[model samples]
Target: MKQAKRKKLKKTHAPTLWIGLFMMGLLVVLAVLAPVICPYDPLEQNLAEFLKAPGAKHLFGTDQLGRDLFTRTLYAARTDLWIMVMAEIAPFIIGISLGMAAGYFGGAIDWLVGMASDTFIAFPFYLLVIVIAFASGAGSHGIFITYLLVGWLIYCKVARGQSAALKNSEWIAAAKILGYSNIRILFCELLPNIIPQAIVLLMTDMVGLLVIIVTLGYLGIGISPPTPDWGTMISEGQTFMTSAWWLSVLPGMFVVYTGVALSFIGDGLADRFR
Candidate 1:
C-alpha cells in the first residue's frame, strides 16, 4: 500500500512542480536578461514615443513618460523578485530558529515566543504591515523592516507546533539518550523534519509578501520612482485606463502570473511533503 502511494505521489509530483518551476524560471531568466533583450532602457523616457501602444517595437507599450513598459516590467521583475527572495531570508532563519528553540526548550523560551507571536497576531496581519511600513517611511527599507518585525510569526508558529510534536518522538528521545547536546539535536534532528513544512510555507508566504510589496508600491510607499515596480505601474496606468489600458493591465497580469507560479510551487511542495 505504501509503495503504491509513493509511486502515485512520484507520478503526480513532476507535472505540478515542473510547471511551476518553468514559469518561475522563465520570469527569473527574463528579469536577468532584461538589459540584453529589452529594446529600451527601462528608465529612459522619450517624449515623442510617450504612451505608444504595444507594437513590434514596444511589446508592452510605453507609459506616459514614454518609457518602454515592457522593459520597465521586466526590470521591475528584477526588483520585486529580488526583494521577494531577499526579504524572506532573515525571517526564515530567525523564525525557524526561534520556533525550534521554543518548542525544544518549552519553558521561559516558549512562553516568550508565545507572547510575542500572540501579541503580533492580535493585530490584523496586512493592517499591521501597512501601519509599520507607513511609520517606517516609504521605501525598500520600510518594507524590509516591516516584514522583519512581523513576517516570522507564521513560520514560528508552524515550526513550534511541528517541533513540539516531534520532541517526544523516538528519534528525539534516542538523540537525548545518545548524549547529544541540545543544540546538536535541535539542528540535526528537529530541523530536518521541520524544514520541509517551513519550505512549503515559504513558497506560499512569498506570494503574500509579493502582494504586500505591490500594494505598498501602489500606495506610493514602495520601491520609489524610476524603479519600475509592478504596483507603481498599475497605479500609474489606472489614470489612463480608458485610453491606454495596457499600461496598468499588462503589469497587473504579470503580477497574477507570478503569483500563480508561486502557488503552483507551494501546492506541489505540500503534496510532496504529504
Candidate 2:
C-alpha cells in the first residue's frame, strides 16, 4: 500500500510541477523580453489611437492614453515580478531567524514572540497591510517597507511552532549533548527541517503579497504612475468600461493568470513535501 501510494505521488508530481513551471516561466520570459518584444513603450501615449479595440495594429488594444495595452501588460508583469522578489526577502530572513530563536529558546523570547504574533494576527490581515501602506505613502518603497515590518510574523510563528515541536526530539538532544553551538543547532540542525514548511509558506505568501501590491496600486498607494502596474491599469480602465472593456479586462486577466500560476506552484510544493 505504501509503495503504491509513493508511486502514485511520483506520477502526479511531474505534471503538477511542469504546469506550474510553464506558467511561472511564461511570466518571467514576458518580463525579461519586454524591452525586445513590446510593440510600444509602456508609457508612450498617442492620443490619435486612444481606446482602440484589440486588432492587428494594437494587439490587446490601447488604453485611454493610447498606450499599447499588450505592452503595458507585459511591462506590468516585469514590475510585479521584481516587486514580489524584493518584498519577500527581508521577511523570510527575519521571520525564520526570530522564529528559530523564539521556539528553540522557549523562555521570555518565546513569550515575546507569541505576543507580537498575536497582536499582528489579531487584526484583519489585509486591513493591517492597507493601513500601513497608506500611512507609509504612495510608492514601491513604501510598499516594500510596509511588508518588511509586518511580513515576518507569519514566518516567525511557523518556525517557532515547528522548532518547539522538534526541540525535544532525540537528534536535537544528542546534538546538544555533543556540545554543538546554539548557532550550529539552529542553522545546521533545526533550520533544515523547518525550511521546507517555510518554503511552502513563501509560495502562498507570494500570491497574497501580489494581491496587496495590486490593491495598493489600484488605490493609488502602490507603484507610482507610468510604471505599468496591473492594479493601476485596472483602476485606469474602470472609467472606460462602458466603451473600452479591453482596457480593464486584459490587464485583469494577466493578474488572474499570474495569481493562479503561483497558487498552483504552491499547491504542488505542498503536495510534494507532504
Candidate 3:
C-alpha cells in the first residue's frame, strides 16, 4: 500500500518536471539552429524587400531595412539565452560564496554580506542596469556585466537562508562534531542542497532576460543594429509600425511566446521545489 501511494504521487508530479525539460529543450533547439534554419540573411538589408508582409518567401516578413525578421528572431534567441545564462552565472558564484560564508560564520562576515546584498536589492534593478550599461558603454558585454552586479543579490539571500536553515540540521552538526571542516560541509553538503532552488531561480530569470535585452536595445544601450538583435529589429520596426506592422510585431510575438513558455516552466519548477 505504501509503495503504491508513493508511485502514484511520483506520477502526479512527473509532468511538471517534464514540462520544464521540454521548454528548456525548445529554447536550446532554437538557439542552436538559429543560423541555418533562418530564411534570409539576418544582416542583409534590401531597400526593395523592406517592410514586406508574411508571404510565400518571407515567413515573418522583413523590417523597414528589408532585413529578414525571421532570421533576426532566431538569432535573437541566441542573445537572450546567453545573457540570462551569464547573468545567472555572475551572481550565482559570488552570492553563493558570500551566503555560505555568512550563514556559516554568522558574525561580521554575515553583516558585510548582508549589507552588500541589501544595497543592490535597494536599487531599482532595471534602472541600475541601464545606468551601468550606459556608463560602461561596453555594449553587450557591458550590459551583461552590469546586470550581473544587480542580479546576484537575490541569489545571495536565497543561499544565505538555505545555509542558515541547514546549519541546524543534524547532519551539519554531526559533521562539525565529527571534526569535519566548515569548507567541507559548505561545498559537499550545503551547496548541493541549495542548488534546486537556484535552478528554479535561473529558469524564471531566463524568461525575463528576453524582455530585458530587448528593452536595453530599445533604449539604445544594448547590442547595436546590423548585428541582428530582436530588440534592434523591434526598434527599427516601430518607425514603420503604421506601414509595416509585421516588422515589429512578428519579432515581438516570437520574443513574448518563447518567454511566456519558459515562465510557465519556471513557475512550475519553483512550485515543485517548494
Clashes of each: 0, 0, 0
Model 1 residue 47 lDDT?
Answer: 90
lDDT of 2 by residue, 1-274 (tens): 9999989878887677679879999889988999999868888989999899999998899999989999999999889889998999999999999999999999999999889888877878777677877787778887787788789988998999999999999999999999999999999999999998899899889999999989989998888898899999999999999999998899889888888888788788888888
Model 2 residue 173 lDDT?
Answer: 96
Task: Note each model's CA RMSD in angstroms.
Answer: 1.5, 1.5, 2.2
What order do you get sorting by lDDT, best first?
1, 2, 3
Candidate 1 lDDT by residue in tens digits, 1-274: 9999989879978688778999999999999999999878888889999899999988888999899999999999999999999999999999999999999899999999999998878988778777877787777888888789888988999889999999999988998999999999999999999999899999999999999999999999888897889999999999999999999999999999999999899888888788
> How accurate locally, in lDDT, is each candidate?
0.91, 0.89, 0.78
Clashes of 3: 0
Off by over 4 Å in 3: 1-12, 271-274
Best by TM-score: 1
- lDDT score of model 3? 0.78
Q: What is the TM-score of each candidate against the true structure?
A: 0.96, 0.95, 0.90
Top lDDT hit:
1
Q: What is the lDDT of residue 29 in candidate 3?
A: 92
Which candidate do you rate higher for TM-score, 2 or 3? 2
* Overall local distance difference test of candidate 2: 0.89
